[model samples]
Target: MTITATRSTELDQHRELNADETAVKSVRARIAEAGVEYVYYQIVTLTGRVVGKVVPARHLPRNIEHGIQAHPGVVADLQVDGSGAMLAGSPERGECVVLPDLDSFGVLPWDTRTGFFFCRMYEPDHAPGDDGGRPVPIDARGNLRRVHAGFTARTGLEMRSGIEPEVTWEVPGLSTEHVPGTPHTMYHLEHMERLRPVYQKVIEYGRALGLDMIEGNCEDPGQLELNWMFDHADRTADRLILHRQICRRVAREAGATVSFMPKPADDRFGNGCHHNISLWDGERNVFVDPDVPGLHLTQTGKDALGGILTHAAASTAVMGPTVNSYKRYLHTGQFAPLEINWGMDNKTCAVRMPANGRLEIKSPDSMVNPYLSHAVLLAAVEDGLTQGIDPGLPRTTGTGVPSPFGSLPLTLKDALDLFAVDQAVARGLGSELADLFLRLKTREWERFCASVTDWERRMYGAEGC
Candidate 1:
């Protein structure tokens, strides 16, 4: 069934269940064949964390017909403000329904008896007026799908992306200590070999769950980056979420702890989730300029880049959500982009054209919410295409050099301020999501401001004594 803005989600649910009997039967057959006993109906939250309910495989048909219900505040991670009030909504707001996407069904490789499905959220049927069973506006995953569909319908172009997620692992025999004169372990073969068992299991599970594992390596002392082939923006986002889950399971089995934190230490290199993006028109890459020389972009690519640069600051609040996320930007010579500019093969620029036909956005950290990030990017690109925005020449100077376009937002507060004013970003996230996101992040910023840190205590404790 086609989902449109005008169509009620209740009607869509009814049509999908009534017409997709064959698909349901197929899933049942697969479940029996795989001996699956339990199923997880997973939902992605506003912060990209996974939250949901699990049901027995025997209840698949019943659950699909009537989705599982949970408090809508899960979208905000059930967070509370300084006054101890629920951030998402009041308790009387009732629960939301989570319906699984049939196409996302897959058996867990770690436990063959268990399977999972990514779900879309909807308001409960007993809601006031016609709001019943309506799509949840604050649902990040659902919002991305809707936004992408609208973008494709309007522009006849598709955005494909691959994310390079860097994670730090705390494992046995892996030391963060660096000898004074010895070479560091970044990309070293010995370090990669030490983490072979960990990466091997991760890749195996990833492949079983439909990730086309391509390559991986050990960067820094305990950091690793394993990548898969890029696909449609929505699929990429789903895979990223799955990848994190797989990493967690692997870490549990290996007696290690994995961290997706952007900056784990003051002296260490920050973890970045750089997005390699391209615009496609059917089989052709619209960003490519085959007639031009090396590392050239088409006019379409330039405009898209302009939009990204134009909205880079506003998007950073989603890309780097945590308080520690801004710490990644404080260090120089760390590959993190400090300036809001594009460059050809320059790793220090916020947006870099590493090769033709794609741009790599360096602003996103390991903790980014891909759903929100991609949605904002789509809006920025759409505005660029519509307005014919032009990104100026690429930067060729060294790191710390200022660009004509100014620097990236240094703090979450700064980014939030920009996000508050940027209509394109607000429109991208939709009004409801934008408002919810702003509220959550603003509370986070305020909490951080109210707390005292070790640095502050160390400096101020002895001052004027």
Candidate 2:
């Protein structure tokens, strides 16, 4: 008797793409047209960092077929645990293959000779058992793609989102200090003028790289929130990653440093990347209630909101991934959401209806990993939809009335504890990714707890003691 190996879902998808000779030819033609000499095969890490190899354009076809091999540890950013053991896997672990999504090919506007493609990782074909050519479980970007696809197939609803990326640029002459008699710089035209060159370069690169430049304004002395049009959740995540890359390049050119830190200082406004999301069923918006006047949500929308609120605390581990990220929540009156409630156009609520059909989640800070954030959100929303979770009444006032859904976690440690127990949120990231994310973040929290800050010295040193 003859036996054959079973094909994994990832291997099936990979095999299906192998037949797309037209797409391969089109990418090659575009590269030739642009006079591109080098191409980057980039993969997003667990922490949302982009890492990959650059190859000469001539090898594009060979690369597309064979793909690139990299250590699986790259997905974890190659981070180590408390004992200095690799958090992802051992050095002896077999390499994974990164295959490009040809549709994502784009040439760098700054460096016309070079182009790049966002890739998905899979276990190498030579891997043992059914794992061969399977999607790497820790591949956050790939996971989001599969998650969204599954959600849409099950519910016939697509999640569309736009991210308001607020970044602080440390320029030579810019100051965050408040002048005693002068008005605040929020939305001030003069402050924007000062950084015109920087924003202009950023917007230019963003548009060239496929972002539909919508609007932007100076939010604080050195903080700016530039926005682009909303799109499918997966595309929006990719755009957010590209936006960060663009800002980094523009900052280098302008001799300024860009900070995506949630809270750079106690007094300064926290840098937030608010996700404005809506659910769509074909051409119709499922979140909008056409029969009701003023601000109202459809049953589907409310259920989704309820699901998100229920899981918000647990999901915070991904939204606010660092120790400093929690500081944004502790700082009072900084526009960061403290409660799990949702209200009409309420900035103080974690989930708020910024528009008739959209909900803006403010808990996600600038440092969030979009892939992980969206995955958790999709899972939570699906739970709400399937279980018919009720969101209850919306809070009309900004007062600290306790939400039945509870408060957002005040620290990374607390958030991780919640994340560890919430199987629903963990399901969104899959078991493998959830475990790795928890390990990496837990290590981060431990490191922060062990280290003494300047505040500690000020409170306990000889001067105070």
Best by lDDT: 2
Which segments of model 2 are wrong by more than 4 Å?
A: 1-9, 398-400
Tens digits of per-residue lDDT for model 2, 205-281: 99999999999998788999999999999999999999999999999999999999999987789998999889999
What's model 1's TM-score?
0.95
Specify the poorest-scoring 10-residue window by lDDT in model 2: 6-15
Each model's lDDT: 0.89, 0.90
lDDT of 1 by residue, 347-444 (tens): 87899989888999999999999999999999999998988888888888755556666787889999899899999999899999999999999998
| TM-score between model 2 and native | 0.97
True lDDT of residue 192, candidate 1: 88
Clashing pairs in 1: none
